[model samples]
Target: MSTTIPGPVLQEADWHRLLLLRATRPDVVARAYAERRRPGRLLSERGTMFLLAADHPARGALTVGGDALAMSDRRSLLARIVAALEHPDVDGVLGTPDVVEELLLLGALDGKVVIGSMNRGGLDGATWTMDDRFTAYDAAQLAACRLDGGKMLLRMDDRDPATATTIESCAQAVSELAQQGLMAMVEPLPYQRREDGSLVLCKNTRDLARAVTVASGLGTTSAYTWLKLPACDEPEVVFGATTLPCVVLGGVPGPDPEQDLRSWGRSLTHPAVRGLVVGRALLYPADGDVKASVDAAARVLRAVQPSARV
Candidate 1:
């Protein structure tokens, strides 16, 4: 008599066979299941992705909403982030775990491109300015949460040995993320300790070139790596650095938002620039209109490329 396996066991065997098939036929499997299995929800079909930077608090940028420590007001920041997320033009957001956790808790992260800020120990007011420690979300945490990727601030002060450690740690982080198939955005700045003992972040042409080289060469895999750069005073100098994709950082809000947008627009058109990662300029605008600011930034991103900007 022909013996038959139990129905459940037979089904399990079939499932294993299918998994093996998929493993061998990666292209077909990816087309069929990768999208569905993707961790975070992807941005809509809009060409450009606008990442709202709200990680100032982690760097001691607590002043907002007219309160010096307004960023500490999680409620207000959460509301603002939710409102930004609701905007049709806003693509994604950039923030530390504190803010990302808030977004996740509020259920606002669904279908959104969530980027975790990896390092924030180099507080703006810290005495040990060059000693930037990876005190935020890490690759393992990001993978555990099924998060999309991570971003780290790597400010190198040649004068300070602490920067060497930061460089090594960042390199390991990049390799770890790559091994896990996660993306990592590295913002490298050549910095120096000033005469007054304060850290002076550099944006000069030579400095930017060094920063780009260091960032691009980090980690074992550069496929998923990206550069977060400043809108250099001299666009030509900054844009000439590396072929790696770049995202212009929206620094502290200035007196002229329009000019700021114009500069950002110029950078967006640069060959190396991939997109924009702005914070105070768009989030804490002088007019306090997040939607309008986001819309304006989106326009710049859209104008640069006909394809989906993100």
Candidate 2:
């Protein structure tokens, strides 16, 4: 990681400041981590959260639609993220350590609800992708960093023996995070192994509902667990399976951004859905205007969610 002052937000003097601080003051990151401010309440009276997701690159899954390396450029990605954060409705961001630390240094994370992504070793298109390894923040690490929560990718495939191990790991993480009084945002997506041995997420209403119940029941205590689910058709069927608060996730970008937003809007009508955590679709949109795309999504959020007393 070159210590260039991460985004377009920095002036020339800031670059020098960054390099010098990195070379002479290695303790700065720890200090920054220790000193980053939090929003105090995870879900304010607005009653819904709109988080930008930036943890994809760590999984070696950077392609946004047709572009193979849409997120490979750190400068561009950080700039887009900073732009998205400028929106008033945007509650926070979820990312791996590298991205989070960079934003922290750039002062882009103050008073935000930061969620640390917990697993990344299960690279995209890998033969063993289902067993997803926990390579990023653990429960203790999240607690020390004072992050609001930890997110785990749970792709449950009945055919894969590795699913058991991943489930056990996620269960422990959920329990540990709960003990620390932190949110455990678990993405419990149902997966199916094809005849060719490739695993694919089963997006049907039934499978998704099953995954939700399974995820909601993880750990000794479900008090601190939240489900990150797909914004599927029949949101009631999928979301009705659990009483746990759910956040709909944006998957790969579709050709039509407006269509995607409409689908997400429908899901928000379901009472169980609290908000959305969108990534490529919101960050790297088809129109290539990150801020406009973010604002559009924000509008969808504001339009659908009922007004609550703050």
Candidate 3:
């Protein structure tokens, strides 16, 4: 892999300049948003998507790997995002309103698939974490901003009554986004509250399958619903639960990068699997090589080329 910077690097000086622009001439953000080049289709010619996920921080989930504050610095995070988007294989970006606005102001989202992340009201360790409310970009905002779609995190906890509210909100969002012909990327994660009152992902194959089934039938219509899921031990089973187009998420990169890559490659071979909506695995890799890590995953997506488009 090459070590060259693909696009304009956001250095310390660049960050300072952005701050000045934001403080003095705030209209540039709006102008940048208006001037952003939108993509004609979500997928590329080979029928694959490589979206960068940056919405985790909005939910107060900023911890990546061993570093507790790995994503705490805005400048560093934006720099990584800019570098990732410069890569040819990176399709688009999925982020909350703030992150999206910052990226737009930086002019890094041109010709990219911009998806707004909705329902980030569920704070990471809050007692009401199950109540994933629509506290971010709504359908109307997404359309107004010319974003390609809206993504929501739907974690269903059987014991938590707040899960019901989340389901209802997600259903409404799905319907609303569909009405505008926008993608509603929903991630249905089955979670279990630990004995210590913390939430942990239920990666069991059966649970994931159940979550997929529930998510696939959320809205009044499933015309524009897309499932963003984590590839589990039983990749086929996790994906077999739905007929909807699925995009695998690159959860925190595991200790073994080779195994992680292989898992993603195997899942991409699934008929329903369209592409990848990854974040930390590519942006904050074990080797700290953002470009190389992104390129490696791009190669995995391209390796399993389908005979037809989804």
Best by lDDT, which number? 3
TM-scores, one per candidate = 0.81, 0.93, 0.94
Rank by lDDT, descending?
3, 2, 1
What lDDT does each candidate get? 0.72, 0.86, 0.87
Q: Report the alpha-carbon TM-score of model 3 versus the true structure.
A: 0.94
RMSD after CA superposition, every candidate: 14.1, 3.2, 3.5
- Candidate 3 local accuracy as lDDT? 0.87
How would you encode candidate 1's per-residue C-alpha lDDT over 204-243 as one tens digit per residue? 8788887888899999889878888888866666766777
Residue 260: error of model 1 in Å?
A: 0.8
What lDDT, from 0 to 1, does candidate 2 have?
A: 0.86
| Pairs in clash, predicted candidate 3 | none
> Once all C-alphas are superposed, what RMSD does model 3 give against the true structure?
3.5
Q: What is the number of residue pairs that collide in model 2?
A: 0
